[model samples]
Target: MKKLTSWALIRQNLSRKPVRTGILAVIVFLFSFTLYCGTVIGQGLSQGTRTTAERLGADALFVPYGYDAKVQSSLLRGEPSSFYMDRRFSEEVRQEKGVEKVTAQLFIATLKASCCTLPVQLIGIDPETDFVVRPWMASAIDRPMRDDEVVVGSKIVGQVGDTLTLFGKELTIAARLEPTGMGFDTSVFLEIDRARRLLLASELGPRLNLPAGLDRNAFVSSTLIKAAPATDIKELVNRISQKYAAAYNLDFVVVAGMITDMAAKLSFFSRCIHVFSGVLWVLGALVMALVFSALIRERKKEFAVLRIIGASRSALGRIVMREALLVSLSGAFAGVAAAMLVTTLFNAYIGAVLDAPSLEPGPLYRLAAAAGALLLGLMTGPLACLPAMRKLGRIDAYIIMREEL
Candidate 1:
């Protein structure tokens, strides 16, 4: 003897045809899920490119000829690679007229490093001369890095003070840096002397055999240069390339050019996702309209009976709308939750696949995205039911009952 209110009736109605209700809910779920994932992914990539550019903090980079791609992959995708250039190359670059600061780093791509399960890049830096990485490290460690002490990137497994074995050498972790959304996150940083020691160690060093006449103590992987104030970056790049390209067989990588290229690719990727989402939105709306129209027809007798039993035209309309609202709300919550879970679990893999390591968005951005997706989801149901509600308003109870017979 419970009162049969509109909401109560709607609950009963949906419970009776569970399959149909599930179908409608699934349609909305797909739309919302796709929208939320696409939005987050696009924003993450754009932000990642900006973060990477800031992290580089240099005008241009110099690497051995034919190894530019290797350096790019190592920086952007966290791919472990080993290449070396003469240490004197950095000294020469430091003396250039337009060069404000110059620093060199040595690279060793290690397999089965104790810091991570996957292969990670090992970097060697001179704390005194390093302008690129030293600033970031300063916040993590107050004192100078010792020969046996190493600094780790954010993604490295162990905490500060933990010992990690590198090339059979046990090194202490002195500090851990904040995430940079670049290959550096999986890299380990050490002093130049320690790096050279590992490279010269007889037992495990010969596997990456050094080229003849290339002294381990005098080899570096890349020369990072910061241009002087108001310096013409293009002219500087051209001058350096001309001087070193043939003489030293070096490649010049302009940081700005790298970012611009990444941005263009990200723009195209974002557009594709936006267009696909738009198409899905339109298709979802159309399908909802058709489904609801048929549902209203099938329930004509049910509405007519309610009207005879003291239900107003408006009340009957409310019944249909309330059902749609319930389904939409449920679908929206479920879809967004699924998207969040998937993204969280596979964030690193997604970045690797996209080749753009992006910083995770703040909570406010996530809240806004969820709100937008839910709003769209909520709107779809009510708008689709509008025509059905109108149809219900014009139903003649007596005529409908007669047709049912």
Candidate 2:
């Protein structure tokens, strides 16, 4: 019976001050917006970081000796870079246990005349098992590489049947691949033989004739190894390095380790985001407290009348808290809906600007936001009602009525 009476009294008080209630509702809306923004940004960062790590598929990467910095910069920072490794290391690594597959790739820098003289990275890989890197690279133009043909990245902006002149040699663009937001987006891929031919030609200052039945491509630039399990891969890499210590001077690089480091850095940034969002939530709660306190002060006379009419101190406090809660819930729902709509609408443009893939908000994110807003709202209500509760408790109802009459 008391709870029913208190609810009825809350409705009466709210109806008496529609404008105050509306103002409190607006404050709650603003608080919810702040929380939504903070949560969405943190989620986007985490998604972007994970996407980047997944795209670089390999438990371990093997690069040339003394080129760790160069390889890391090129792969992680999207810089145009190159390195070299002897072909002997590829054979030695293949013989090691736990090695599933070994592929050699060559990365060379070329000045393409068609793309406005931009320096582009040219990568050469065997198409047979290169699906690891070019998994999504469909033939958007002529076809996959034939002899003396090259495929360009989607960003190259060359149409089908266009010739790209690189190092004074004209090669037909066989195909173009979809953009991956990495250095590969601006690169060109060709068969290993063609890449070696181009590199040798550039070095010799002329098209060098290959000796009959002899391929001059004695060494590959780098080796990519696919191994089973993290521990096994690490052990295999170590064994290969130890066995060929004197015979091969090539460096064995672990792409997984680099990616793990990147993940750690990303996690650190996500934590920072969480802390920032927490601060915003606190600020919103404080604002709400002030707004509710002001509203309670304005309704003091009404509260006193209720107290005189047999309303207990607790009942009066419940009335104020109920109003605050109603405002917060309505406002929070509205704000979260708005934030989700806005994020969905501009997600494509935002992803482009951030140089990352589009982010889809997960269920966990929405649930957390809803629960957080409610708790904050509930906490703010009591904080706001404290002053009103104290004033009503100390008031002399007989004197208030006598003075008013």
Candidate 3:
């Protein structure tokens, strides 16, 4: 006896019900698309949070009490802001016990086409005392920045010696720093002397009620501090707070943390995406199961006819399973392709509108997501056919055959 060929039967059965097969495939495609997108977003957010925090490279940020939120928004979103504290405040923090290093920074906001464009956080640092920005600049350009020259962020559009108008002053770009998916990516670091001169000539100088002499060393926007090893970070913050409490008004808020809040928020958001993905998966599974169940029910007569022709029940079952697989495979391919197109569009254009610190998940993560979607889509085929397989085997074959006759 010639045994039935499941492969040939699988093709014939699917081609016979093109509409049904197509609908089933569309369902699987939807499942794959959502899973792929969700995986990428969740993974990207997680990586961005960590990279943004590490790029800060500080144990704590000390700023004016109410400016804490603005500083965060400034660093993360590049929102324009100009806040200042008396210079003596910086000197006092340095004397605090267990404070290993302290650096003062001045943030000057300017027009996008001008210096300090939110993309270029116009900042001034004393090269001799700067422990933070120098390391990053050194790696990108072999030579140290000279006066009247500035180091730009990786994303800033320009080449060395290209001039930028910062605070009405055109300064030469000395070097560009490597991008870290943080505020630094757009930051423009200048020597303290130049940054101070530029700030004084800008509108900020008049707005801050400058002294008659207009001393640059008199005010700074904020301070970045690092604690000595083994020193309790929280304790150091407290000590700094106590020292300032009696002498100066409590206008400064000391942030003894890195990207804690941002990271936590992103983590929660990623979990929500995962939950949404799970719900989508459940819906996809139910759709696949119901459609296949109804499809098998309609094919009862077809199975009965095969039985009369000497086709075994198991062979008939294989045909249905194979058809399910082809349908699912088709959907998965379509879904993954759609997901790739959507992601590419976002990275190329839509992402800039967000104007927030972000990191692209590496290739390894993206590949894993695609592979997972493929495997999951393949599994649904057999799982959806379970009930149909049993019914095809146990159904009253004689009744189906009699009805067909």
Ranking by TM-score: 1, 3, 2
Per lDDT, the best of the predicted structures is 1
Error of 2 at 46 (Å): 4.5
Structural similarity to truth (TM-score) of each candidate: 0.95, 0.61, 0.83
Residue lDDT tens for model 2, 1-405:
456565676677677778866766666666666566556755664564565456656556677567766665555434566666666576667777787777777777664456645677778876665644555555464445677677886567687678887766788887777645455666787887678777887754344443233335755666777886655767777877677645656566776676566566656655766676577556655665666666656666666788878888787767766776766677667776776676657644554454443344566876686577556644554565566556656666667667667
Better TM-score candidate (1, 3): 1
Clashes of 1: 0
Ranking by lDDT: 1, 3, 2
Q: Tell me the whole-model lDDT of each prediction, alpha carbons only.
A: 0.85, 0.64, 0.72
Best TM-score among the predictions, by candidate number: 1
Candidate 1 lDDT by residue in tens digits, 97-116: 89999998888888787778
RMSD of each: 1.7, 7.8, 4.2
Q: Which consecutive 10 residues in model 2 have the weakest lDDT in total?
A: 205-214
Instruction: Provide backbone clash counts, one per model.
Output: 0, 2, 2
- The RMSD (Cα, Å) of candidate 3 is 4.2
